[model samples]
Target: MTDTTHNEYTLTCRFSSFDTTVDVIFNNTVDTINDCQKKNYEGFISKQDYLVPEILQQVFEYYKKSYPDYYQGWSYGNQLTKQQIEENLPTPTNAMNLKKFIEPLSVYIADNKNCEEGTFGIYFDCTWDIKSSLGVVIKKWKVAEVGTGDIAFLF
Candidate 1:
């Protein structure tokens, strides 16, 4: 429906259902994504637009369960990992209690398509209490209508 042009990298999208505007990221170099898959992104957006909150909850749950080891790092100080220790970057704890720290930064959608459907991902800046960002693909967001899995599915 909305055939807006998007360049590679980041995009800004508005979800009218909730009056939300979020940045969108894309990696066109993904081999699984073709023109059709790209266009299918629009439909995925529409389908999951209303479930944003639920999707977020699911993202946190998935992170806790799927990557328990990763989530078990730090509660107050830097992590023991070589990179984290060398960088002296303070490790953060699970966002279960630090919900305020979970900042939704963007909505990433591929081009759009017909045959194969491509879903979108919600990228959140969970750095406040996590290692990297917490990216929720329609998969991580996990509504059957959109999908279920990790953020890697988005690209």
Candidate 2:
């Protein structure tokens, strides 16, 4: 059996006087565990390290509150119409922009991770299709870029 563990964290952020909740998960591989430990990072250093969630929750919260405008823009996700996009000037979620959005925050691991690899973000209540059998409208947001890595399409 492969040794792996799942660590989950819930981050709630307020923007434009609205609150959105994000679910963050870390599915750690053995290599990941070993790497974290070698770096002198605290915590159990397991796939589901307890410390990671605690730290990420606060960090994500700060990230959301600090960049209300960024979150506000994405709250609409892809539902924005061309008129709204042009009129309201909603920010598009992209690699270059995401790097700027998250640059102000201090998440060491995040600095080395990217949406396509390091971290996974799932946004709940992001769409209007509340009755869609898949549960509440599900939307996604990936970190896209970490450190100096190239950015990919946003979630």
Candidate 3:
């Protein structure tokens, strides 16, 4: 049997709010146990490393859920209050599912408006390694950029 003892993986997501850009970096070792484990665990762990984007998403969702009138049909130019933003932090389940590791470095941003022109950005950096028994490791990372006049796209 081919030995699959060592695998390493890394994923980096950087979002430029000022420029409205989302950048992703994924690195992994394939066909080897060590590489697979490393990559899988790294990607999973990295999810919890960044909080900005995750928090932003939660805040936006909370706004949509609570004060719908203020945000309805607004655009990217809208501004929100710090209090409102803080109130939007994700629930325990949501946070766990989004990022496997919890740390202080994560940051989130949200435009106060409720229109297509409004923009929400998230940035994530993470790393991990695979285990000996796991097979066919799959790691998926998704970032959704919401903005005014732009349909939501998952990348």
User: RMSD to the native, candidate 2?
Assistant: 13.3
The 10 consecutive residues of candidate 1 with the worst lDDT sum are 140-149
**Candidate lDDT (C-alpha), each:** 0.49, 0.28, 0.29
Measured on C-alpha atoms, candidate 2 has an lDDT of 0.28
TM-score versus the correct structure, for each prediction: 0.49, 0.22, 0.20
Using TM-score as the measure, which candidate wins? 1
Give a tens-digit lDDT track for model 2, residues 32-133: 334432232222122223333333343344333434554455455578665554332324433232222221111222212432323432222212112210
Off by over 4 Å in 3: 1-38, 45-51, 66-139, 143-155
Q: Model 2, residue 99: displacement in angstroms?
A: 19
Candidate 1 positional error at 68, Å? 6.5
Worst 10 residues of 2 by lDDT: 132-141
Error of 1 at 130 (Å): 4.5
Task: Point out the higher-scoring one by lDDT: 2 or 3.
Answer: 3
Q: What is the lDDT of residue 77 in candidate 2?
A: 55
Best by lDDT: 1
Residue 15 error for model 1, in Å? Answer: 5.4
Clash number for each model: 10, 1, 42
